[model samples]
Target chain A: MAKVYDAIVVGSGMTGGWAAKELTEHGLDTLVLEAGRPITPAVDYVEHVPVWEKRFRGLRDRNAQLANQPIQRECYACDEWSSKFFVDDHENPYTTEPDAPFLWLRGRQVGGRSIMWGRQVYRWSDLDFEANLRDGIAVDWPIRYADLAPWYDHVEEFVGISGEPLGLPQLPDGKFLPPMELNCVERVVREALAKRFGRERVLTIGRVAILTQNHLGRAACHYCGNCERGCVTLSYFNSINSTLPAAQRTGKLTLRPYSVARSLMYDKKRTRVTGVRVVDAQTKHDIEFHGRIIFLCASTLESARLLLLSATPELPNGLANSSGQVGRNLMDHVMGGGARGRIDGNLDKTDTGRRPNGIYVPRFRNLRDGPKSPFLRGYGYQGGGDREHWGRGVDQAGFGADFKRAMRDPGPWHFSLYGFGECLPNHDNYAELDKTKTDAYGIPVLKINCRFGENERAILKDASIAAAEMLAAAGAHDINPFVENNPPGKTIHEMGTARMGRDPKTSVLNGWNQAWDIPNLFITDGACMASSACQNPSITYMALTARAADHAVELLKRREL
Target chain B: MDRRDALRLFSATAALPAVPDLLVLGRRLHERLTARPALRTLDPHQNATVTAVADRILPATDTPGATAARVNEFIDLLLTEWTPQEARARFLAGLADLDARARAAFGKAFVDGGEADQVRLLIVLEDEALRLKEQPGPHPEPFFRTIKYLTMYGYYTSEIGAKQELHFEIIPGRYVPCTPLSAASGPPGGD
Candidate 1:
């Protein structure tokens, strides 16, 4: 009775956009349900706007931050420049344990977090895929680098990534655009890491989703350096900026903004997802849209919440969650640690514009084919050297004309190295539906209980030591390095709730990202991650979504339903 | 956030923000009519004292300093709108301490005192504020440190100080990481 589309993708974020593009290009009519407002980039994207032009003079509204966005305020992107990209924490409340602080920084908009992503794109290799199985902790990932390599090529070809080739087996090279040049300090750090520390710890220009050259009708990055705010030139890869527009060009896509997908309608007798139950964001009324297949790409925790909230009498625990792993094994990258120091003699040097990219030190611990280290997995450093601005003016000794003269010369170029370590998936670190909490739309919210494990703390300590060593090797002075294993989910790389694995008994989704029990339902977002790889996960999500969409279309054509 | 350059805002914002005072707006409007831009957060005496302190912190020479850049107005605006009540209270108390010490020494208000008197009082406050050894005051940093920091922050970030003095472009379209300071323009432009 309802308008039945070929497929329905819940969410319009990173994976959702990819799914839409892939499905529509494959000639399967697809519907994209977004819970947030349609992004109007010209009006919304405020890149390059100077701080002095802002109403708050680049200062975030403290009242709004303190009252409504306490959690969101914790994010660097939640500043005066692009706070709109983040959700007000009050409107989208989630509970966390008193001791374990889990930061769920989300943007409920058409572009979703792709509009506010770090844009760092890294390829996960066999090292990550084999970690869980080798350690005998979680179920084995059904597929490995070989299976996802082509998909990575497919996504990278479309999304022009700007990076250098490392040729490392654990970190494979992708179809890349011209890489941006490293600064003087970054070059020094890279050399020091290579010559002094050896090839185990490799430093290269960060592999980023931002384009160094034009591709796919999108202009190259002008290097204005503000990628977090929406890019008008389509320089970086964001759904609203890239894939969604491509999907629209196909005309096989039906984009329904402000359609908050509540859950998938599971047909028990048919053993397939019949449709998706959505709530109109404005009207606050439930509506149903039938689809032959459904893709749940509504981020990690949200996708898990959708299933946990849809627990039916037939599937008492949760649909497609026969393994009882629907809302379990939550993991995020262990962050909030590293070291920084002053780099003198670069006084004449200045970064004219913000380089949207930074230097990256690839994972060096517990490496591939090498002797096992103290930790199971490893961590990588992502930071660069830059000159400090007048914000340092306050603390500098002296004032008046002399103080003014002192500020004329910029502060010494400071080199910092921060570690983004892999967070091991612990069964106890999980999120489930909070019975007490409901969002503005009256849908249940998540109650997260995620924290960094012992491995994370140890890795952070090692990362700090390594970062300090690299800085020193680079001839850094007044080096003050620190190691703090911050709360989980702080990096915003939350994953592994509906992890894909070989066994149906141990995992919710199969290698194809299809639920083992519900053949017609697929999840290819962070929820589909089998393990929390050290690299940024967005690129992987894009690859997996494109691959899964193609697989879904093949299954449909075969009349498998 | 710079690839995680210790996003730890070691400054005052790292601590729990103090409650905002409600009377801030009314006082803000009153100060506007009294001063050129009027002060919202600081009273007449406090405003005069802060203006004197800011001017001394960055007095005018060949280049425009704190007063020319309206650093006092900037401080007032932040105190009224942005500064948390606890920090604002400590700041105002710090200004009062400067005035009280000035009176105790010179038998006149800080603003009423000679340039030398203001400089001497500021010197003593500077010594008192040096306990933190800089690094943005570990936040709620004692009063003199906070005021001095805010004064410089307001000055250099203002259009006059940034565009006129240091001379960096707000938006340089492309990134040239190692350009000479005098080759193309002044110190690479920032907010």
Candidate 2:
């Protein structure tokens, strides 16, 4: 007889780790299927590795990146040391239109992308949840801020977010530790913005998933300045740093690395997903794992691809895709429109240590009480002020002793404000199976077709003008306001496709993130997102995963699953 | 946490508080240096010319210079392995051109020329680089600017340059938002 686990969680990443921890802690024997190699922190963590140790110094291996990770190299985190965390583009192939180039940045490992995540955690408000219904853009979200508030509190408590309380309704305050401080120039800009824009444009320290003080037995951040390279102190909230360990503490987690899930096993008679068929990455062999309930926590596009791959004759579109929304309405944050300027006067002042977090300007546009804009949604700015360092020597033409001495001292303080605008859920912007090409594992790849709409561009244009206006108000010089034409999926906050909604006829999943068609199947990752909010999506994904796991456990106890 | 529990959690714990042992870091850097073979590509004359150009660009001041940081060695490594064939060929040709110009000016190779002569020749190259910057087409980067770029890149990223010159700390323990310029210890590469 095959060993049937109580629950099976796919993709041991941000959401998968949370689901595993929540389910296993409730005394369920959960098996975590990770498609990538297991990480040994001591061996793999490269945050402490000095730039001199790398062969390319911080330049990155150009030849290797061009050959293996042409698409992965598009990411800022895919540097010399941390590039190992990202997937090789050849092995994990996905296609996009020549005109519509989608950069599918992925990290397939035990901890997944959580290892190289940006760590900026922000909670979404009712403003975000009810945006679709208010605008009549797409189907309304089944859940709201009220429903997910407790879950946000639940995850934020364990994750150890450090942020200031702004008391803003649009971007609600979370359970925070000590907020990281704003630097001298940042403070100058913050005060200037406060005086000019009042409470509408609040510039606060970034609410990050990094420990300011030790909590839950994990150590506080050592201020290494290299969170993306993997934090050794467990100060940052990567899955391996936090949730997976908590799951392991319960002694009910069975983590299986290098198990690429091929598809879900659908039982037409039972009308439930019985198990998952996986391909062993190392041996190139087929294997099956049975579970009472399944959590499809493989990211947004991958989760949608999984459903498409599991299409049956009974339901030809896809598994649990009765609404035909499994692989539709894809969206990603349209970023790269803002300004940079020279914030003069702070010459005597400088900052010590490398603070991992930056200053965040909360979204102020298109609020309920605020003045209306031409665009439908809003955008937020994430940037900071820093004095120039030795890297500035590249442009300075002077050579010799004086130049060398000058390079040692910090240069003029420069401030930048980069915006991330909300991308509307467009049905045409979606992913489907590309039968012509298969990955190294021989599984079908995704053919994504996504592009930002007029509203997204308008929001970005407004963001640049507004950023420059703020900089001018701050008495800045060399105010260069510009809009960057970044392609879709560049921000890596890709969401939607298998979205949650009120009706099963419109959405794949319900309010609880459970598949409406399959009772035991749940998709709690970014695929469950109905709308693309300007804020970072990981924290919401974590909250939804925990809430869904709780509901799943309840169903199991009642023998209803 | 008790000793038994701490021992069990050692693997689960991301890392034992990131107080970097400079001794271990130094030893590993030393081992890496000791294991390196000779320069694979650059001949003696070309190597000497590169060393001379790098030194003039960032000569030995109160602190060490490009030579001390082994900018020549870094250039050799890049040319041999990292740089594309076309770029590598252009770089070698540029080095040869520098020698020819040196001979034309002072009847000697760039390595054999005095500091004043080398400076005069470099001034001409800088002017060319500046001119190239103004008129942008598909022209390959001016050779002198490339050398300068490599010299700066190689020097700043070196252990001596980054640690001794810039004071880059592996673990800066706590973040201090505002401090006097004189009080600031590490190089300014913060968020």
Candidate 3:
């Protein structure tokens, strides 16, 4: 007889890491199965080396990207330094209509996209939670602000979000460490924006996951500026650096990497998840493991894809997709609408060190007790200040000794504001199985049919205008607003495929992130998101997973599973 | 050897005609070097010419420019290796038409033109390229957009370009968002 575990987490990514850590710490025998290759942190990270040290000087070969990740080029970060972390697009092909293009950026490593995340951590307020209910779009989320507040605090305390307390309702205040200080230009911009636009528009240092001071055995960030290469200092809160190690310490966790979980095994008599079926990526052989409970944290679309592929007599659409909402309401933040300009005043000033993060302009419109916009939801801005570097004159053919001397010093101070606008959940924008296409493993690929609606386009247009206006108010010169040609998922913040809601008729998961149909199975990744809040969803995913794991342990003690 | 003989020898040594009777020689060289079943889907002639135009726009002078940085080669690699087959074909077809127009006007191939003549030709074609980018109907050229990207990538990545032109410090360990204008002057130092 095979040994039965108390729980099995389907992924070892952001939420899966949290689930494993919390479950094992609670003395539950947890088995974390990762679909991708194992990531050994110390060995994998090569960020500390100088640029001259690498073979391609941190540049990827043309053949490598073409043969491996054709779809990943949509991301600027998927270069030679970080391409290894991204999924091979050719092997995992997906379909989109000719008119619509969906850029599904993913990392199938143990840490998942957490290793290559932007590290910005912000909390959503009642404004985001109540948006759907107010607009009459999707069903209202079962849990509200109060229910998630404590979990946010719990997550922030452990993750060490570096930010200032801005007592704004739209952007709720999180438990934070000392915020990173703004540079001179940023200070000027912040003061000017506040004075010119009133309290509605405020600029603050971004709430990043990187630690300001040493906490939980991890050292503070050294400001190396090579974050995409992976933080060797463990300053940034990646799953491998924090949660995975914590899970290992409990000794109740069994981490099996390269174990691709294909689907969940349902026990008809028990009316619960009996086990999980996995295929060894290397051997291509199937293996079954029995678990009392299961956690589907295999990202948003992958989790949905797994269920859609696992067809049964009871679940023709997919497992636990009773309401046909398993792979619906796909949303992502609409980005690339912003402005860039040269600052005239700061021509002589220069700063040292490339800060790992940027300055944030919190959600100004539709905040608590603020003026509403024509659009249903609101957006935030992530901008930064920097002196123009040597590369600005390359188009003009400025070179030689004169060019060298001129470039030795910094040029004019420049600023840019990029919008991170909310994408309203539309049931029409969804992911489903494409029977026509199959992966190397012979599994049907996900067919993503999504496009930005009127709301998202309006948000982008307003954001572009607002960004230019902000720069103009800050006394910027030659401001230019850039509107992206692509649609919603271009920002790579894909969410809401298997959303959590108050009603089983409209959602696949409940308030506790447990499946409505299968109580033993929980989903706390981006899939459980009821709405795509403008803020980065990783921290919230972690908090939700931790809360769900605690609930799972309690339910197991009572023999619920 | 005379200039024409020298051009021919040079072209032969470089694996092609330096100054051939036919303008298509340059086009054929590009096609032969970049030939691959996967790559054949996209036209190499269009990719090369567009890259050449980008090189002309930001030509190599005292510092490295687009061609010297192998921006065109980079683009070819990008198209052949990464770009979808459909996009590649569209890019190539657009490039061929661009060269054909240049040949019709100058009575010589685009590559064989004097620097001033080439600059003038590009200036005229730029409007057409821009139109294609903005209101792309059937078989959009995307020449202007590709040129813009190539210029951005080529210039930013060059050593003198990034260091002198952009004034980029490989590692500015600290961020001072607001600082005195005078603080940015003088030699590079710790943040």
What lDDT tens digits, residue by residue, belong to model 3 across residues A1-561?
Answer: 999998899888788889988899999899999978887768788665554333343456656776678888667778767888888998778999988989888888888888888899998878888878888888898888898889899988988889999888788889898899887788888899988988778999999998888998998877767676787779898889888899999999899987887778887676688888888888999999999999988999899998888778876888888879999999999887899998877555556556688889988767657678898788899988876654454433332345444644666777899998888888899999999988877778999999988888898888899999999999999999988867656677889988999888889999999989889989999988888878877888888888888888888889877
Give candidate 1's error at residue A245 in angstroms.
0.3
lDDT of candidate 2 over A15-130, digit per residue (tens):
99999999999999999999999999999999999999999888889999999999999999999989999999999999999999888999999999999999999999999999
| Each model's backbone clash number | 8, 0, 37
Candidate 2 lDDT, tens digit per residue, B26-90? 57645654554588999988999999999998888888999889999999999987999999999
- Candidate 2 — which pairs collide? none
**Global fold similarity of model 2 (TM-score):** 0.94
The positional error of residue A516 in candidate 1, measured at the CA in angstroms, is: 0.6
Error of 3 at A459 (Å): 0.6
TM-score of chain A of 1: 0.98
Model 2 DockQ (Cα-based): 0.48
- TM-score of each prediction: 0.93, 0.94, 0.80
All DockQ scores: 0.37, 0.48, 0.17
Candidates ranked, most accurate by lDDT first: 2, 1, 3
lDDT of candidate 1 over A502-560, digit per residue (tens) = 88999999889999999999999999987887999999999999999989989989999
Best by TM-score: 2
Candidate 3 Cα deviation (angstroms), residue B29: 38
